[model samples]
Target chain A: MIENRPFLKFIEHLVLILGVLVVAFPLWMTFVAATHDAARMGQVPLPVLPGPHFFRNLDVVLNEGLWGGDGSGVGYMLVNSMIMALLIAFGKIVISLTSAFAIVYFRFPFRMGFFWLIFITLMLPVEVRILPTYEVVAKLGMLDNYWGLTVPLIASATATFMFRQVFLTIPDELLEAARIDGAGPFRFFKDILVPMSRTNIAALFVILFIYGWNQYLWPLLVTTDQSMYTIVMQIGRMLEGAEEAPQWHLIMMTALLSVIPPVLVVLFMQKLFVQGLTETEK
Target chain B: MASVTLDNIQKTYPNGFKAIHGVDVEVKDGEFLVLVGPSGCGKSTLLRMVAGLETVTDGSLKIGEREVNNVEPSKRDIAMVFQNYALYPHMSVYANMAYGLKIMGLGKAEIDERVKNAASILELTEEQLERKPRELSGGQRQRVAMGRAIVRKPSVFLFDEPLSNLDAKLRVQMRVEIKRLQESLGITSIYVTHDQVEAMTLGHRLMVLNGGNVEQLGTPLELYEKPASLFVAQFIGSPAMNIVDTKMHENGNEVTIAQNVSLALGGGRLKDRAGQALKLGVRPEHLVISEEGANTLPLIVTLVEHLGADTLIHGHFGDDKTDLTVRCSGTQSVKVGEKLPITASLDHIHLFDPATEKRIEF
Candidate 1:
């Protein structure tokens, strides 16, 4: 704005357009594939323009679910995924917040030791501990249940550390003020600490919801029952090698369906998400 | 509403560093006691111990006749306004003020009434009350913070340098408001500040502290005119009191300054301490340029600061390297390097035992 350089501005616009095309091209192709009939999808030189069978494909996917698989509908899978995502997001936030509060505010015998223990878990992600976690869930008889799917992934070190950092930035005087105001520990946490970190919570919720919704590995390992299969994992079942080749149209439709809720979450909470992501301290 | 007493209160951290060393003071019912000191002087540590934010390491604290050494801060019935104005940033002004009442489980109507009353007393508008803390100006936010404490109606009010965050003009404005508000409410209050002016203007009695020990406790004028020790004398005033070493004469009636300058003690004030080394103290305003006096010292002016109303001349005495400052009328015209004889009235002069750092009698 200060220079008013036309050539530099033109180059900026060109680079932005290229970035947009790079991201949008895959999404455009998925929509095009979802719009065509199964026969049209398999033909040479797939349709660049969206076909007229978009509504039929959506309806078939929603009601019939994935073809050549279990009879459970895509609608039910969508509901299952929604529950898992919400539980994971809410559970992670609650646990992380309380743990972070304890770590930051109170002094206990093993406080730093416990903090470092949680920090070390960040190095061993779910992928590394997947088998043992699955065995424990199965031994606890939680396999094929919502608890098995969400709870193992709920105790997040990343979320806990972020909340710890957020809590540390809060002024110590606020705690003192609350104490003098006749509010004990829990009341201070609820009335002051939680409300103060509102934007960060919402932002974390957006990210966690997307993370939970798109979860494939853990859900695949535990959900042997097709009734509890998430939409993301169910799409994988539809792509198994079969006699009539893969159903490209229906699988693409399910992929599109799985992406919607998380997209809506990020879209609606975009402002808070950006605010929480950018501002570490007030 | 209630009195606070700290009996030999000591605060030693878990790592074995003592912040407050056996401070004992009594704040009468509805009296404003200001704790003033330099940073790390344990004024804040003492205030926090009174607020129950820090544990009393080895003493007793009582509020309203109840020993609260081991009591929770909330149960002790005190409210604190922090230096940063620790208002809940996300809450509206009304919510911030009502939060404590709500936590105490007050009914909706009662909470609303108290919040409204406090808001009105603080001169905050309805619109301002509805806005969040970040939306208000610094002074308005400070008022909201005070209103938060006011609505609680606690027995004691604790302020931790609340106005230190404001600009000079706003700080002065809030200082008067705080003093007036405290007077109108008559709550037993304890305030902490490193600013001497704030401490002098706000407190009914001032507690001057140094290095975790109580240096002196008295009215502002008492501490001003008769500081208990050398530390209190230098800490209480602007430009600090000028202290120079003076050797007592063998005759017991005269004190020699820089080997040649001598002043008479006027009698019996130094009967037992004739030959001991003492410190001579005089305020800048007390020393005036004079033609002839027995106590007069010839001063070579090195720097002059003119303030239109008064002039501060910074200089040293004849043949000595020790620096001294003199506050004189602005109308008096004098140049640097000019040797002028300056003298202080005998009554305004102070004597301190340099070894003990205690003020000498008379």
Candidate 2:
């Protein structure tokens, strides 16, 4: 920057443009294919530009199930995904907040042991404990239910750590002052701790919602009922019996629909999301 | 509007380290008692124990008449101004002041009235009351902290080094403001600071602590004139009291000055400690420039500090290599390396037993 090297600046811009193209190319291809009909999609080197059948394809996917599958429309799948994402996001925030507060404020017996136990769950992804977790869900008769789809995945380690770090940075004097002000633990948590950590909560909500909406394998294990399938899981089911040419246009349309909610959420709350992501203090 | 009585209170941490050895202090109604000491000397710990912030490991503490050793901090009827001025960062100034009253379940009108009154008393404008703590300056933040305590109207006020975080000029200004506020409210307050000047100016009674033990407890003038030990003698005064090793002469009539020059001890002072070693303490103001004569020390001035109103001459005592300082009027012309004869009156000298370090009263 000090030398004002035009060639170096040009090289920097060139690299950045290349990086954007690499990431944006797949999304572009998906949009182009979603605009075509099944016939255009089947042709070799399928039409690179937009086609007129985008809305038709979206209408078919949202109203009628694709690939001759006996299932509810993608609209119903979208509703299921919304419920799962909301429950998981809000559930993780509440659970992590109370647990972090307990761990940080109280000096109970085996406090650290319990904390480490929760921290160890970060290593056990849903993929690793798939069979046993499914068996537990089956025994509880929670299959084909919202609880089975979201609750098992809501015990978050990263959210707990973030809340713990935020709580630890609060001055000890705040607690003492609140205590002197006649606020017991529950009142202090409701009034002081929760309000102070509002940004962190919003930020974690964005991340957790995306994480929940994109979940593929776990929902596949729990929901054998077609009506209970989420949009992401239904997209996978469209690929079965594809020895003939697959329905590329409808698949692309479903993928685009599944991605719209989270993208809109992040874009609308982009400021709070970035602040919550990068900032711990006001 | 109540008395605070600490009867042999003690604090021992969970690790078995005793932070406050048995401290006994009594704050009468409307009295301002200051606990003054160096860092880690347990001044803050003692104040915390009284505020119910720290547990009393051994003895009972009473506010008014009830034993509050086991009471929660909220039930103790006390308000504290922390050193960092811990205002609720998210709340406005009025809300910060009204939060305690709201928690006490005070009505809306009553809370509003008290908050407005406290804000006016603290000179916070209506526009300023709606701003958060972060929007205020350091001095304004300090006043908000006080306003929070004032709105509570608790029986006792606890201050834990509240002025330590301010700059020097602001500290002086706020010191006056705090004194004025305390006088008007007439609350029983226990203030803690490591600054002797603050303790001297603000306290009706001073309790000096050293290493978790009470060194002396008295009025500022009383402690300045008649210290109980060597530590008190040195700690309370600026530039410190000059203490030197000296020997008592035979017949208990005189003491040696600078190992050889003998100054006669008048009126039979220390008559019982004959021919024994003792420590001598003399405030710099008591030492005068004397003409060359008997019972005088001829000193070569080493450093001269002119403070506009007074001058301090630092030098050794008569070439014996023992350091001594003398205070004189600022108009006096004194140069370094110049010999000046200095002497302290016998009536103003303090003698202490070397073994005990306790002052020997004449």
lDDT of 2 by residue, A1-282 (tens): 677899999998999999999998888899999999988888898787999998888888888767566644699899999999999999999999999999999999999999999899989988998899999989999999999999899998889988999999899999999999999999899989998888888889999999999999999999998778899998887877467767999999999999899998899878888887787564
Q: lDDT per residue, candidate 1, A144-189, as tens digits? A: 9999999999998999999999999999888887887777889889
Q: If you assessed candidate 2 against the hidden native complex, which CAPRI class would it receive?
A: medium
In model 1 chain B, where is the ten-residue run with the lowest total lDDT?
B265-274
The chain A TM-scores for the candidates, taken one by one, are 0.96, 0.94
Error of 1 at A192 (Å): 1.4
TM-score for all predictions?
0.96, 0.95
Per model, state how many residue pairs clash.
0, 0
**Measured against the native two-chain assembly using Cα atoms, what DockQ does each of the candidate structures obtain, in the order listed?**
0.74, 0.70
In candidate 1, position A79 carries an lDDT of: 93
